[model samples]
Target chain A: MSDVTALHPGDTGLSVATGRTEALTGIAAGLAWLLAAVAAAAFDDLGDWLETQNYAIGVGVFGLSFIVLGLTGRWFPRGAAWVTRAGPWLIALGLVLTLWQLAAAKLGWLPQPFFPPPQGILEVYTFEYEELASHFLASFRLLAVGFVIGTIAGFLVGVSIGWSHKAGYWVHPVLRFIGPLPATSLLPIVFFAFPSSWSASIFLIALAAGFPVAVLTWSGVANVNTAYYDVARTLGVKPLGLIFKVAIPAALPNVFIGLFMALGAAFSALMVAELVGVKAGIGFYIQWSQGWASYANVYAALILLALLCSGSITLLFRIRDRLLSWQKGLVKW
Target chain B: MVAVELRPEQPAASAGASLDIENVSHAFDLDGSVLRVLDSVSLNVEPGEFVALLGPSGCGKSTLLRLIAGLEPPRAGQLRENGQPITGPHPSRVVVFQDPTLFPWRTVWNNVALGPEAQGSLKQQRERVDATIDLVGLSQFAKAYPHQLSGGMAQRVALARALVNDPEILILDEPLGKLDSLTRLTMQSEIVSLWRSKGFTSILVTHDVEEALFLATRVVIFSERPARIKADFRVDLPYPRHRGDPRLAELRRESLALLGLAASW
Candidate 1:
């Protein structure tokens, strides 16, 4: 890690010569964004469409910032290098947006209602942001609560089943039976059984997250090197110490894998639970927007959901890397 | 000023404890059938004695070490340490297995501190742990993780880990079996010096006849499966015994002959 950080600029992918090319790409990305802005503003709608809410201006500013970054890259070398790495993708996004403007709102090649232009999507974020933000918050809250409860419960269940033969005999069969079934399949029963849709949604998310965690935790505990237990025992470690210190630490790598799986499962469960009955969440928002034929709002909510999930997974990976830094060449991230 | 101390004063060797293994027979349930591993194996080790058990690959030497360490109860007989029956694992009786088995997640210092940490005496034994690390010549690598250390260094850390407990009886199950020849020779001497300084009752299981002859004051040879002691002889040598000693060479040949590997060599 230190070696990479200490590398000279000449040895890096973004050498002085490449740095110049990166600046040019940044400028090119900015120009493409400017073109997208012009395309959105210059063209007249084929039919009556909702107000774009100064979406063109927003696009213009985004383009301007890119142009500025490209021009002033030398002042912030590191930040500019990062921007340079992302330059091609930025240009591609601009080209895609410009094409969307031509196809949907301007030329009517694609129906306006079903396939709203990038500006239309931007308008949802700009104008109906309050509603979207509220739904996002609601979704975030539900997912957070459900995932936390599920992970904690799963960890306990897994540890218990792993450590004791009696617990394993009882819970292992139940887990094997239920663990494979998708939490979404249990929606009808869960909704019927729980008092409120909110509680039901939480339960569903928890169920989705919990199963993987439980199974993986159990695997980790059960598969711990018997030598570790022997060492601890000879050292006068009590039963509880054996579980917490020896078993748990050794099982952490496996536990992280389970946590990652649980995160994915929780995301799936959260969406299904929200889509089925939750009044205010991104999933419900998407459903409601689809009902109103507001595809732009749907697209915006989907983007937010993708960001939330990916960001969460990234955060989990970061935590795992830090915790398991001691591990070498055994498992790759 | 009055000061209260919670535990007994730390002893270097903790006054080596005598071990008495009396007609101990052990077996394993292999798919519902009892596969006997030991047959009434009886041996008495005096305090501070370095006794090496030499045998073939599957001669149950390790199983006997485990029995002595109280990792498992023998099927038929009792093993006593300092006149007390070893029902289960105790800090005073520790085994260093063939594998270093240091926790990958822990630094060398933390690994060495495991005994005290497990016994809930880490706060008091911290200095002893450091001293043991230094004793094994690993003071510089105390903060290094197990994965970073070479095989020999890892074994040294394992030694420090067991020694930090101030164990009276140190059981070694082919502890140096996996090391390279050069490192193995260095470690053999280190073990001898440590045994001398600590005065712990050491029982080592080794496959190498020369190793047994060099390090142990007494070498006990065992027969094949369900191991029974075939021969026991004393190596009457002083500290820092030379590898080229004619007496050691004579004993190695005898040990090899007993294990039925003499004809090949």
Candidate 2:
């Protein structure tokens, strides 16, 4: 077994192969820079381009970083380990970017406005960071509030429906009928029912998040091994105690499954909800930029949305790791 | 090593409870058809007696153990402990099933601590949890999750969980059935010693006649499904009985014959 300290790259032993990989990564990065420099110097017909000079500076910085790394990387084993791990991916990314630049800016094979240069996307971050940040924060707030409320409500309803026969008899049919329906299909009703667009959007997001959590939680609670209840009962655990202590803990892996499903649904709902008259958020920004025919801004917003959704999911996974550590090897993720 | 005594602080009078099963009959509904498992079975287990229910596979020995544990009310008869009728499961009667069934989410310590926690006595009986874990020789693994432990180790944790309750009647439903032969032998002695020290009324159900003869004061053999007692043999051996004892060997042969395995033996 590896020692706990091996979690730190500095504490890990390095091989000659790893050092060689790092050197190769540096060479690939340098080659990418050379290609980008030649393309920029040679081509001048890439008209009305935004942040055209910034690409050269970006390539130059990348090349210098790799060259320095190749020379001094062996001295810093931790940094060298990171370089080795990312080496192949870095090489692929460099090659892809070189090809992309050659096709778009140099050859002009792709149509204008449809396929913006990579620098056009980067320029959005530099020029419109404040607007993007505000939209991001707005979207984040709606997601957090909707997710928290939805999950709490789903969990309680699920436990109730699962644990009590009467509750299941009444609630199960209702859930079955409503849970499968798309939350977006109710957008017209949601808009009219709520006092403001924000509340309507929040409602849509909540509805989207709630169904998966409720369904999965219900299944989880229902399918727990009866032996656990038998054990708890023999130990003199009462109904509430049995549910909280035995059933909930046993159902955690399934609950996490529900949470992941909820996240996907919530992200979808947030985008759709924002497009329906919400002035702030990534979804609104996408629609707003598309109206002005700024496809570059649309692409930029899309990239931000991708990062945001993935980041939230990753955060949820980290929480699951902390809470359900006992299920570590049992689950592949 | 001396058998680790359990609940030494509790009064001896409240330690073991006598079990009386009167004309018990049990059946399950299989696709709307009645499948009788145990029929007209009656037995009286004395307080602190170590009794083994020896039967063939599918003979409902485990069903009987579960009845005694009060997991279910018998279909026809009354099961009583210390003159009180058994209506439902209680902490006083605990069963160790063939599968350890330790909550996979809980660590060894939390699993052992469950009884006290359930009974609302965890604050006062906290040390009993630690002591039981130590007695089971799993002190070092108290914080280890159930998945981290081997089959034998998980079974040991299950035993400790029952022992922590200091149950008056400890029901064993082929608790060591899944273990390897070597671990099975070791657990047999461990169980015997625990029973001797704790003085709980132990009802161990096993198909192994030798195992029954080794640890039990009396071996009750059951016939095929719709099970009824075929024979009850009193083992008059002393504590710390050896597997190689000639008397045990003799009784083993007799018990095997009673179990309808004479031709095979």
Off by over 4 Å in 1: A1-16, A47-53, A329-333, B1-14
lDDT string, candidate 1, B1-265, tens digits: 1121222223234458999999999999999998888998889888888899988898898999888888888999899999999899999998998999999999999999888888777888778887889989999999999989999999999998998887899999999989999999999988887777667899999988888888998988898889999998899998679999987888777788899988976
- CA deviation > 4 Å runs, candidate 2: A1-14, A41-45, A328-333, B1-14
Superposition error at B66 for model 2 (Å): 1.6
TM-score of each: 0.92, 0.92
Q: Interface RMSD, all models, one decimal each?
A: 0.8, 0.9
Q: Go through the candidates in order and give each one's DockQ.
A: 0.81, 0.73
DockQ of 2: 0.73
Tens-place lDDT digits, model 1, residues A56-103: 788888888887887777787766776688889999998988888889
Residue lDDT tens for model 2, B1-265: 1234554333244467999999999999999999999999999988988899988899898888888888888899899999999999999899899999999888999999999898788888778788899999999999999989999999999999998887899999899999999999999999987887778888999888889999999999999999999998799998789999999988988988988889987
lDDT of each: 0.87, 0.85
Q: Which ten contiguous residues of candidate 1 chain B have the minimum total lDDT? A: B1-10
